[model samples]
Target chain A: MTQGMSLIVKTITRLVTSFITLFGIYIVLYGHVSPGGGFAGGVILSAGMILLLLAFGREQTMKIISHSALVIWDSAGALAFLTVAVVGYLAGDFFINFLSTGEPYRLASAGTIPLSNMAIGAKVGAGLFGVFLALAIFRPGRHQEEE
Target chain B: MDPFMLLLLALLAFMIIGSLIAAETEDLLSSVVCVGAIGAGLAIIDLFLGAPDLAITQVVVEILCVAILIRVVLNRKDETHRTHKDTFAVGSVLLFLGVLLVLGGWAMTTLHPFGEPLLAGDQPGVAQQYLTNGLQDTGAANYVMAVLLDYRAYDTLGEATVIFVSIIGAYVILRQRGKLRHDTGNESDS
Candidate 1:
C-alpha cells in the first residue's frame, strides 16, 4: 500500500507539472485576449520547472538541463525580442508595428505580440531555472570531499 | 473632507509613523523592514489614487531593492560605524529636511496630480496613441505590456542584458576563488 501510495504521488506530481507547463503555453499563446501574458506565463512556466526539480534529484535535472543551455536560451530570447523591436523601429516610428494585422482572435494573429510573448516565456523560464539551480545545487555547507 | 483627502492624510500619517520606526531602529534588518512598510504605504496611496500600474511597479521594485540590500549585508561581516564626524553630516541632514519641507508644502498645496498622465486615451498625442491603439493594433491584452515590450522595448532589452550580466557575476562570486590543486579544463593555464 505504501509503495502504491508513493507511485500515485509521483504520478500526480508529474501530471501536475505537465498540466502547468501546458497552461503556461496557453497563457502566452492567448495573451492577447486574457489577463495572463508573457510575464505571468513565464513565471508559471518557471513554477512548472520548479516542480520538476523537486520530483527529480538535482543531479538528474542538471544532466538533462545544463546551465550553459539556460544561459544561451536567456540570451537568445532577449536578442530575438530586441530584434523584433528594432525591425519595427527601423521600418516605422520607434517600436511601431511592422507586421500585418492578421484577422483578430486567430492563431496567427497579433503579429509580433505572440512572438514577443514566446521570447519572454523562454527568457523568464530559463532565467528562473538558473536561479533555482544556483540556490539548490550550490548550498554553502556541503563539500566535494564528502562525496 | 473628500475621500481623496482622507486617503492622502492616512498615507501621510503611515509614512510619518514608518519613518519614525525606521529612524529609531539600530538593527539594519529592522530598519529595512520599516522602509519596506513605508514603501507599501506609498503603494497603497498610488492604488487609492488610481495608478494601479505604478503601485505594482513600486512594490516589485521596492521588494527587489530590499532583498538585494539584505543579501549583500548578509554576505558581509558585522559592520561598524567608523566615522564620528558630525559637521558635514549635520549640515546635510538640515539641507535634506529643508528640501523635504519644500516638497511637502508643494504637495499639500497642489490640487492636481504632480505630473500629467503621459499616456492617455488616443487623441493624436505623442504617447496617447500608443496606449489607445496598442490592444487594437498589437493584440496585446495588457496596455502595460504593449508599452514595455513594444514602445520601450530597447530599454527592456537593456534591462534583460543587465540581469544576464548579474547572473554571470553571481556565478563567479559563488564559485571557488582559490586555486585548485588539479587544473580542470574549465580553468585557464595562467
Candidate 2:
C-alpha cells in the first residue's frame, strides 16, 4: 500500500532535501540571533524528514532510521533537554545559564541556551517523525485483512 | 482605510473564500488544497502583522499538513457518503453563527486598538525589562528567544514535556499489538 512518489517528486526531493536539513540546523543553531528558535527549527527539521518519508516511502525511510532508534532518539533528546535544566540546579536555580555566556550575537554565545535549543530540536524532530511513522505505517488491522 | 488595513482585509477575504471552497468542495483533494491556500494566506497576514517567526512556522506547518492530508486522500476513492441538506441542522448552525458573530463584534469593539501592543496590560514593565536588559542578562540578541529560553525557562520545560507526553500518547494509541507474537511476556515498557 505504501510506495515512493512520482519521478518528478523524487527528483526534486533529491535536490531539496539537503537544503531543508541545513536550513533547519541553521535555524536551531542561530536561534539566539534569528527569528526562529528550538521549536520552530525543530519543526522545520521534522518537516524535512517527513518530506523524505513521503517521497521515498516508509521502507526506504525506515532503512535510514529504524522505528526503535527513533523512539530512543526522541526520548534521549527530551532527556538531554531536561538534563540541561537539571544541571542548573547545581547553581541554585531551576534553569540557570550556568555556563559562561560568550559575546552577544556571536555564534557560540547565549550560555546554556544553545545546547538547550539543540536538545529541543532533536527531541521535536524525532518525536514528530515517530508520530508520522505511526500514523502512516504499522497498520495491523489492514495487514491482517490483506492476509 | 490605511493601505495596511486594506491589504489585510484583502488577505482576509482571500482566506475566507479559500475556507468556503474547502468547506463546500466534494473533491477531497481540492478541499485539502483549499485548506493549504488558506494557511498560506494566513501566513501572509502574519507577515503583515510583523511576525516573521510566526509566518515561517505557519508556512512549514502548512506544508507538512497539506502533504499529510494529500497522502490520506491519494490513491483512495471518495467512499464517504453524502447527506442531503437538513433544514433543522442548517437552522441550528445559522443560529450558532449569529450568536458567534454578535459576540465577536462585541469583543472586537472592546479589544485593543490595531498596531497597539496586545499583551502590555497592567504589567507592561515585564516586556520592557526583557527588551532592555535581555541581552545583558541572557546574552541573547533575540529578545523573544531570551524570554523563552532564559527568563521563562520553566514554561519552555513544560512545553517540551508536553510534546514528549503527547508523542508517547500517540505511540500508545497507534500500537498495533496488545502483545507481540513470538515474544515472551517478560519484555516490559512503560
Candidate 3:
C-alpha cells in the first residue's frame, strides 16, 4: 500500500498541523465568547491529526499517538465532563452552575463552562481520531488468505 | 428584493443544484465533492441568517464528513453498472418528490415571517430574556453558550452522554471484529 503522499504534501502537513491544533485550542478555550465551541473545535483538532496521518503515514503518526493512549484520553475526557456535571448537583441542582460568576466576557468568567468545553473538546477529538485509526487499521481480508 | 435577500436566494439556488448534482452523479468522488459544496453553501446561508455559530459548526462537520466519506470510497470498488432495472423505481421517486414539495410549501406558508421574533406582546419572549440575562446570569457573552451550558445544562449533559455512548459503541463493534480476525488467524496458523 502507498504509505503516504509526496514530500511536498508532508512538508505542508507538518507546517499546518500545529496552526490548526492551536486554532482548535483557542476555539475551545474561548468558546463562551466565540463562534465555536467544544464540538467544532474538537472536529478541527481531529482534522489536524487526520491530515498528519494522511501525510506522515499511519505508522509514523501512531508512533506519535498510540491507539491505546487515544482510548484512554477519550475515556478520561468523558469521565471528566461527567464529574463536572455531577459535582454541580452539590449546588442544589443537577448540572447547576456552582462557582461564582466573575466579570462578563473574561476568560475566568462562565464558571465551569470553559472546563466543560475543554473536557468535551478532548473527548470528541480523541474519539474521532480513534474512529479514524480503527477504520484505517482494520484490514478485513488481510488475514483471510493466510488463514 | 434587497441585495442581502438576492444573495441568499442565489445561495439557496446553488445549494439545490449542488444537491441534485450530488445525487445524480455516477462518479463517487464527484458526488462527494458536490455534497461538500452543498454543505458549504448551507453554512454560508446560515451565516447570512445571522447564526455564525451554526455556520462554524456546519463547516467543520462538513470537513469531517467529507474526509471520512472519501476514505470509505477510496477502499471500495467503483459501483458496477446495473443490468436489471425496475420500472416502478423512477415513478416512486417522482411521487415522493411531489409529496415532499407539497408538504414543504404548506409548511412554509404556515411559518412566521423570516427575521420576525415569535413573541406577540410587549413582554419579552424566552429567547429575548435569555439574550438580556445571559451575560449577568451565566457570565457568558455568547447567549448560545449560556443557554447550552448553563440554562439548559441537563440537555447538554444528555448530548455529551450520547456522544460518549456512540464512541463506545463504535469501539466495541470494531474490537469484536478485530478479535474474530485474530482468532481465525490463530486457528489457521495452528
Backbone clash count for every predicted candidate, in the order shown: 0, 0, 0
Question: What is candidate 2's lDDT per residue for B145-181, written digit by digit as tens?
Answer: 8888899989999999999999999888877656354
lDDT by residue for model 1 over B49-168, one digit each (tens)?
776656655664465446545644555554666578799899999999999999999887765454455344234585767756776776655566667666666676777677667767
TM-score for each of the candidates: 0.65, 0.86, 0.89
In TM-score terms, which candidate is top? 3
The weakest ten consecutive residues by lDDT in model 1 chain B span B114-123
Give the residue spans of candidate 2 off by over 4 A. A1-3, A6-11, A140-147, B75-93, B118-124, B179-190
In terms of docking quality, model 3 is: medium
Q: For candidate 2, what is the DockQ-based docking class?
A: medium
Report the Cα lDDT for candidate 2.
0.85
Ranking by TM-score: 3, 2, 1
Give the alpha-carbon lDDT of every model: 0.68, 0.85, 0.85
Tens digits of per-residue lDDT, candidate 3, A31-62, equal: 99888888889989999999999898888888
Can you rank all candidates by lDDT, best first? Answer: 2, 3, 1
Ten-residue region with minimum lDDT total, candidate 3 chain A: A138-147
Kindly list the per-residue Cα lDDT of model 2 for residues A78-131, writing each as its tens digit.
999889889998787989999887899998998999999899989988888788
